[model samples]
Target: MHLFRSMATLVSITGASLILVGCGQKSGQQKETITTSTDSELTTVDPSKTTAVGTFNVLNNVDEGLVRLGKDSRVEPGIATSSTVSKDGKTYTFHLRKNAKWSNGDPVTAHDFVYSWRRTLNPKTASQYGYLFSGIKNADKIQNKKAPVSSLGIKANGDYQLTVTLEQRIPYFKLLMGFPVFFPQDSKTVQKYGSQYGTSAKTQVYNGPFTLTQWTGTNLNWTLKKNPTYWDKKHVKLDNVKFNVTKDPSTGLNLFNENKLDMAQLSATQAKQMKNNKDLISRKQSSNYYIALNQKNKVFKNLKIRQAMSMIINRPMLANKVIGGGAINNDSFVSKDLAVSPKDGSDFTQDVTAPTSMGYHPAEAKQLFKQGLQEVGRKSLHFTLLNSDTYDQKQLSEYLQSALEKLPGLHVTLNNIPGRVILSRQADHQFQATVANWFADFSDPITFLNILTSTNPSNISQWKNAEYDRLIDASNNDDGGNAEARWNDMVKAQNLALKDQAIIPLYQSGEKWLVKKSVKGVIYNTAGANYNFKDASVK
Candidate 1:
């Protein structure tokens, strides 16, 4: 599940200058286009429907929300020039930038924001990100089909001001505004295109720094042309940004070497080979990669089986040798450096009170697997491991398949599918086991913890623990105002999940990329969309 959300411009590690090859136009002038590659294909540009990082990254560039992420993941003005908060922190009023206009020449008004929020919260829309609107007044009721979408606590105060009411204060509400899911959509365009909206480049309109072009309903490549109509277009320097879907690291590296791409991500093997390359830029992500077993499967229903599965994989070796780069093994679902304890200022992962569940112990794992098989009235176990068709994911899946098969009488098969298909299947609970990634939408442990709640759409595994749910609920509502108490509740919830082996937390992502020195000002966020090209330029 590419379930997400921010960030700063990337600086070179070795201070080496790389060159970006600019495409030449018919006029003989070089176009400032920064060519990049993503391993996954874009599913949709619709903010409401996006679940994959590729979709969110595309939407992040082609759309504008109330606020946009700036350097260091700070909230900066977007369509909204300024905002004011009520003393209770439940009411937020945003003053829209009067000059902002959509690509279609319609003024970007407060009504657009109001309409967008209501549309996403509408049960008929079936937005997976709807869970993110939990604290908004009437949002939960609407999502649960108990209230009408119109009852959502948001209104357009005239044409240039929007007011939002929340049932309770959300600590990361401001950060959420910068996420593509919270961006405003054009009501007229959406209504005109109906369900076809966002299926292709021409079906949607843009109000951000760039306008998408050259994208068919399904294509391997696309372009984001600078939006002349953008309110802040003056600050957007790149004339065009080109993207290609390159699933293989070898292909991406070749593209980079051939000067066809400004940036290319490296595989663990490639990262090792390029360790001394000045262009090698390594980024530690606030994201977690884990294996989620579907509880509906009989073999996985046994506690011992689940624990044994986690124990079988050598996570440290996976992170250090196999995944390599700067990847780190983790025991808890919440990635480190994501949040700090309000009480002691320690990293959230440092205070986990649970026993280590991620350690590799083949002997204990084999014994437990044998017992689990007998308990389940089976002599052998077999299941498919679903994963994305990217090189890195394929490698990880292969490693898991080889490791899990080490358990006696356990046969594992790999089902590598497109990223879009994986998202769809994961949402529908169509797999027995899947490799999933969670990119934090904000700098909070709750972003990772709350997703495992029994009712959350992101909880594809259907893992449920009443105490875990209670702790998460308390953290969000009862102890939300008390920072220390909320932190404690989240800590307990994380430890509970780890102790239960709810999911096999593998590693925190440490992606290495070969970026051209000529590309500058691109904002790279570890947690969310990962890239923002608004201020980016090809020098």
Candidate 2:
């Protein structure tokens, strides 16, 4: 079934209203709780296997790694209480907090992390995020099946001591540890559930501030209850967190008006209409949304055709006129707020300029399109454009179709499906072109640039450039210890990708929401899960 329709049905449920029941304070007790809505349903609960935003939201509360994002986006100790790096910056040793324990009453030790990391790096796991572990010694070899998983550079010196070796210096390694991919998993629980692990709440174990319940793997509603076993439970004020999957803007607004939800994500139109509302808030996310043209398609393989397609879209109009509320037009694939130049400390986006071919020019686009058609011996070109079925995605796809169809002899057909279906289709290379977005896993340019490499599983475009690959390799391996040299290499690689029109960048997303004034202390990170409710409270 299409996920959008399923979510709509879930949101339409009346009577009983689980939101009130879940968020209400118990009798004679002063407890805080929150009711919120996500744009879509969660795709997975397993930390190592998930790539969806909704899934990350749940995992951030139910599981944790060596470090976690604290209030105000500060890095705080989680399983590990302290850590030290070698003088060469190639080795790190962590001392685990002995008080940490899983929800099932099992101790969370360094061995759990070793087991989890090896599982994620194993080729049998088929994790798309395996590329994230590249800098760890032997990680690439393990992913390529050239070395055994046991050979990966992680060791449990004792129950509380964990040591890690790296091939080169990674300035953002601490930040990377806060991501879900690096979280630990219980070996016994994983073996007990076998393939069913993390498919539903029943098959998962929690080691963080909350425990998931009532998730049937296909439902649109779920509940998060405070985990009494959490090591840092004293700081967790929320007794429960109720989440409802909402796809329609009208429904979310109605829920917010009815006081059934403490926070609701708003559409651009809704934000404009309710701009005067005191509860309205806007969050500028560090993310990039773009269109990925599959180079496997014969028509898309032409460089002039790709450049023409990219140049025809008016990004400013899309960001301001179509989707307002502070959404910024982006000429490059890397987000504006992602990172800074190591040499000058200036924002990465400000330090680099996009290639001329990526700029908007209708006349030049028409001429290039005509030349491309002549070169490919075609009078007209037609291709399907794939996107999610959410309200915003539908609008974005329609806008693209209208703009691209204005070019002579070019036709675009949009296929709007469920979010899950769109992800599967992209991974399988089932579309000629598609609109997609990438949220950075860490605060670095390599987090965005590494995905487009030829061997990275996330490169759905099937674009392979020898020079681009060489630059990325050098940034990660050869000059990784030299921050300035690594930054220059990455910038050159991004420029080359733009010159070749690897992808057409549209705009960086801006999150708009209506949040209750009583809620406080929710941490919003520039990378990873985006939200952390560990210290959240409602008065």
Candidate 3:
């Protein structure tokens, strides 16, 4: 998923013993509840419409896909009890659990998945994530509006069986299935509310361990109650999980100290201040923050200007001093330590060297900016830098504004807004430049590279290169099962994007949190959905 906000509050606590907390209510005892803080507000809970990590975090508990990510991100059966793959690795058949049922007591059937998938691929749905269905047969055509949605290669074999056909072998198919966007939706509930489905808590139904409630469309808080009818309800220990939106670190810290919150995300400054606190914890994320220059703007189309912008800023200082919370500088769009060489198991970052033209060089940047202005026939360059209103993003955007203005005759404006607003503006290509980030939807390099492709909906920058597209396409479809060849193709694509300055890689995102010691069994993963609290308990 493309992360428009920092997922700091989505803490990772996995594999811990499930002690009795709120497993069952005794006659007069109070129900155990865990209150947590989120920095960004969710715009929608609809799986097909979600584009933010915060919403995915919520759906990760309230919706169950064919499979679920377990401790360490292992693939575990959820709605599907088991699955089989064809000898060609191009087809998959899933056997759903007979006991699975929605909150409305309707049996979860294979037809639900077929309907959900077709709805997402429907052009009217306008799901930004439709690009993720590339490997599925006829999906590209359907998304392009060149074929009917009924031609999609997914079918319900019967009431409890589903089969999916792919145009090619998708290395991460199972991992992608665990994502919320691929989760099944009850057709009855969706049709019951029509356009209003998933707009509020009452408009949708749940099939996961938790059921969402009290979330009006635009509210700042919501509650996740343990679903009594969930298939795995016996293992759910928490009775209620309360989520509060607290954008200010100070406010969250105050609430945490007051014991009002079981977990609170800390800002970089707050993390430093609470370095010695026993409750403070830090987790690394498989996400990359970068600057996207909209090529649709004539000022950004000049290659030298893009290179000058990349060279003028100091990434190490920005990561360590401006956005620090264990954040590390990144040289490429694809995050470091995400994937490795298929042959020797060396880290992907170890194998790909950053372009020599990409490092900080203020003197060179000034000269390039002067030349670029001449080529573009402009004495001065002016643009706006869009960023989320969160504390960390504000600081990072300010740093960029100050650094970019250092160029002669360059004027930079800061447009700070909520994360949801940033996403909306970027999606419409309504901004000059924006600080954007991508969290890996699956544990693969294609997750990041595909988003930058010319035809991908997520490529808001509008940067395109035929060679780059060819390399990525070959890696996705034409590698012929040669692991080393496929790896090399992707490596070449990453190198090309960096050399062309299509986007400026800033740093690898990390999170700092203050979680109470009693919160247990919240599974965390660097990739995929970051947190799952289905089995979580508060002691």
Candidate 4:
């Protein structure tokens, strides 16, 4: 499950987007005279928002969920010490920590989850992740304006026990609970701050391992200081965790080389160049990169054209030469190695597989293009491939543009924009096609695959199949269905998604990162995404 393109990460943009630095400075102006050991070009810091790097760093040292993802990527008790679910996996009863209190010295309770979920789905929050909870009973109805917030399937059994009822059986529901959107909010704080809640460090209180020190509302750089109130404070060892936004891979690498940045993404060229370095480490993250066609658009309506697009490119070469060698050839929308593969703990030994049609053959691509042109009664066509303007994405998009033009009737245009603008276009459906990668918030295929499908609320690609939708509905409705049989149905749905050619499946994802080996307790879960730093301590 890819989040932030791999593990469970979410960075949906809203009104004003700023890269949150894990510091207490609102302007991200740090104590310049302090003995700062790392270096980078982190310009702004805001509390209202955070970058992928900032979110993860803050997750462990600052934000505390009812439960947290352990360093092993498995679920462990957070504020809640233990939880019990009904036999059918429909209702979850959580036993919250009696002494677990917020930074404000307020006790955290089950109602926090209820309030957070409702606030996220409140229509006004406009949380794109609100759809992530659609599977919850009444969630869809409330989000769709078909029901009331009170009807949401959660009840506060007294104050400590949160009894949650899902719409159907979700074997992986517990893992989903560990995602960021599901994290609890302070009711009093949210109401008092209103729109300003979650917008700044001063406005928010810490319940996790670290507390936000100096981040302003604008995101750029910030730090996480040890939280004295953390129940398990003894297990957290880092005196402070700093976050810097390194959007440009080359610049990030430069800073890393200069010893200004401890960790950063390497350019494909930089990664290859540094492959032999003592500090470089590559991980096959649970994420995939691919294009999504807005089926509602006429250009994407023809399957042949879609197939033609898929067949023209050489994915393997792109992975090795353009996107960085560590990127797996992701032809399947879901990471084949996602979730803890029962067959093996490692992704290489996982049971996940790509779609049958996920392949590249120049001859096949040309043939599909010809067929598509004939269907549309056109000899040639033009379209643009939209992508985020980041360095790696630019290289990847440009490479695809050159490759796709191999087909005689195709004229591909590359449209790259800032991250903020790209997110806007995706939400507003302003482009014909987009190169987007989805990450999972939990260790389940549905978390990634289902959202890309045509019937999904987040399905910007407008294609829909009755059979595909039916199968998903069936899986969710299966109360006593055999587990193996359920898997068969899921495969059927994924296969149908492939068969429609509505969206092209690229290679499954692999994570790649560079870390200072001294940082221990950063657990890596092969199932869902995200690095758990709850117990991680710097040597």
Candidate 5:
């Protein structure tokens, strides 16, 4: 569910220096590449690997999905030109445009979807993301090896009509389709190349607006040439998108100053320095940064300790001091500004849960810790908090360690590991409490809440409330996704989650990035995946 949009150049998202050099001969001079961070180390772009900045940054242009999210956060056609839903909402049929073709000029067909889903769910493939498709028929059973892959709920009626069936009603189904998990794959290419398929540009084929060119499996740079077979070939304007990974902020900034990088991520210091500047592009997203307590631990199971931990942290200090102004202290697990109003603009959620406690309050936090300790009959508590080893994660972890110790009886230990390791440990439920962040896979509340269900593979925290799960189920089924009723169900769900205090909400993200003035048509979207490089252009 960790879907990527923009590629970061350095470890830090905020502005860094650029170090990765561009690839291919200089045919026509264009604007420089955009890095999500200001870092200076260069990393290679590989399409098969899941990377935030790399895939969507430049190499993503060559990849074709069934549907693409447009600048308006609306579902737009990609491989499939049009689709229709059943009156019961259980069946969705799509019509693939006749002209859509792979980079090899072979027609991309509905069977591609059928083949791809089976491939991703093939237990031998061991794709961790197979759970995202559980809403489809027999997906869970297949992933669990209880059923064969053929039972998956996708059918190719012809060269054009791709039909899908859900286990039940799902509201964000379209948004799920917009995700890369559901994108089609050419059966022949994948079978022929075996393990080497999609590892390099030459090994794979394209059907989107761009055709990838000149990327070896380990190359730090890649180029995407426009695909003439795109359905809307006329509107697919950019000739190609070139990407290079730069891992240092200072060097990235140097490139920015020299007009080489078109856009870059800013560091806390950099954002603080440039926030008010006209060139800074800041966006507040519907993402919540929080700490997930593994309830399996006897110490963490104590509500008193949970409440104490929640109360003591200074959220505003982190927002104001470390994160700067683009972030706001969050109370509800779901970030504000996401589906706050109905399509017709009416309030949906009633503020039933106590407002999220954000900002620094050492005194009250110490008192709560004392109260919790006394109630639990414990003289002191010890626990390790895990986080990803990224700079932001380390920064946040260190700050939390200092803040939590101020509480007399609470001693916090910090462990910073690779993001992949962090994810693995989390899935294994191997920590006391961990800093967890979620970027929405789609534009629905269910996208955030449903994944935390007791049975979900991604439910790493093992925090489950039957009532909360029920509400989420209602939102996905009866309420019909992103609806006012669904939002109401979400408000109810978050309130219940707060009442249980299984997790603490910290701050919401403000989608902040510094884009040099010359970049255009980056295909930015507020919801779902944020950017598409296919249409990106440099003037």
Candidate 6:
């Protein structure tokens, strides 16, 4: 359920004066290549279809949106040279760069953006990301099949000029433009390939910093060659970026030791062992991990049972002892270090408080468990906890099983599967409970809070409350113009969700890595695509 987004770049430099090694080839024509590894296999290269971290990593490099999340998470112009907002803030007009072109040498125009947006909102596309276009006029109606895609409130005034009308003013609309879901599509290529489009590297086209190559329908390895047609190709330093799928931490570490990789992520245990290693670096990610209790299950339908489940786990211990590397213990769904209150510029996490029941209270939990079991008229309860097959996820599931079984008449089992399979199963509601993480798609608290809304396609837990929905709706409409009022409404909604025990928040993740000193200029953001290697170079 974790919609993977930004990853922070952790770099280790020990010397004040560093030697710069030129990675140039003898011919001075071939570009230098950098190698990296990912833990999960990519699901798709299509911007509209991708939902996993691996796919986002590739697309973030290979495709260019109207605007791109640049170094330090700042918004930078991409295909669009500049933009202007109407006085009322309901309309946006983008002026595209005339030199931008796709990999096939075709001009990238405003129509491309219009077509891509409409296609994403088309009911036939079945895009889970269409929800992101909610504020765009008629976007929600189009996605819900109530209106034609032609009415989506976006139009191409000319080859380089585009206009977008919003149903309401969206504070984060510019940031939203940087997301992969908002990237333009090559309609000709998509229609030509039909279902085969984006299934393999050969079927795709690129207009960003890199062009995907050497990726078949399924493979453990792929290459991203610099896109010569890119408008800002002069700024793209690396000749190529080679990526290999390495799910095993030991194997990734071994690769890094052998000088085969420029960067590799380390597990908590590995990171602890290498704490003194000069190459070790840690990054605090803007994400939250939690166990989503499926409300559709008869046992979980009891509020007491859900509360008991939430209280049994020691989140601080899990974050520090089990999943160390700067992981922060979190009880609220919205991650800390993400947003701030517009009224006083105070941290959002500090303004809201989860109920005390969210903390470890085994004594109270036992009493709640007893009451819950009696309410359900069950003498004993047994359920399986689903999780990813990764070493860390498996360890987390085992820890939860051990802790939850302490309750009387509770028998817990663990089921670990591949990351993709786990996501698919969760989407199908095939589990009673599962451990999941959600990375912010944007900077706002709404990025995390909106997912649990009654109508969100990403609501795997199936938890719903009328008041919660009302608060979120009010924040978007009644309080839309008032930042302070909207912030208060969101904070209230978060408290209500936690009070209902909608999901048990465990910790906010922190990425740990071993990176080569030679790799430089890599941009990591807290939102959108986590990593951007467009400016990266091996020196």
Report lDDT (Cα) of residue 267, candidate 4: 57
For candidate 3, give the lDDT: 0.81
lDDT of 5 at 80: 80
Once superposed on the true structure, which residue ranges of model 2 sit more than 4 Å away at CA?
A: 1-28
Query: Each candidate's TM vs. the true structure?
Result: 0.94, 0.94, 0.95, 0.85, 0.83, 0.94
> How high is the lDDT of residue 369 in model 3?
91
Tens digit of lDDT per residue, candidate 6, span 226-310?
9989999998989888766565678878877878776777778889899999978776666777888888888898999988988
- Candidate 1 lDDT over 1-539, as tens digits, reads 26311001110000000111222122125457777665556667888876666667677888999999987788999999999999989999999999998999999999988888888888888887798888889998998999999999999999999999998888889988988888888999999999999999998999999999999978877888999899998888888877776667788788778877767777788998999999888776777788889998877878889988998999889998877757898777888888888888899999997464578899999998899999999999889998766666678888999999999999999998776677778889999998877777777888789889998888878998999999998988878778988898998898889888888888776777888878888887766666688988766
* Candidate 5 off by > 4 Å: 3-60, 104-106, 121-131, 138-147, 167-169, 192-205, 211-235, 244-248, 341-352, 355-361, 371-378, 479-485
Q: Report clash pairs, candidate 3.
A: none
Q: Candidate 2's residue-wise lDDT over 148-197, tens digit each?
A: 99999999999999999999998889988988789999999999999999
Instruction: Please estimate how well model 1 matches the true structure, expressed as its whole-model Cα lDDT.
Output: 0.79
**Clashes found in each candidate (C-alpha, N, C closer than 3 A):** 2, 0, 0, 56, 38, 3
In model 1, where do residues sit more than 4 Å from their true spots?
1-30
Worst 10 residues of 2 by lDDT: 10-19
Candidate 6: Cα lDDT at 330: 75
Output the TM-score of candidate 3: 0.95
TM-score of 1: 0.94
Off by over 4 Å in 4: 1-57, 340-357, 479-481, 526-529
lDDT, candidate 6, equals 0.78
Query: Pick by lDDT: which candidate is best?
Result: 3
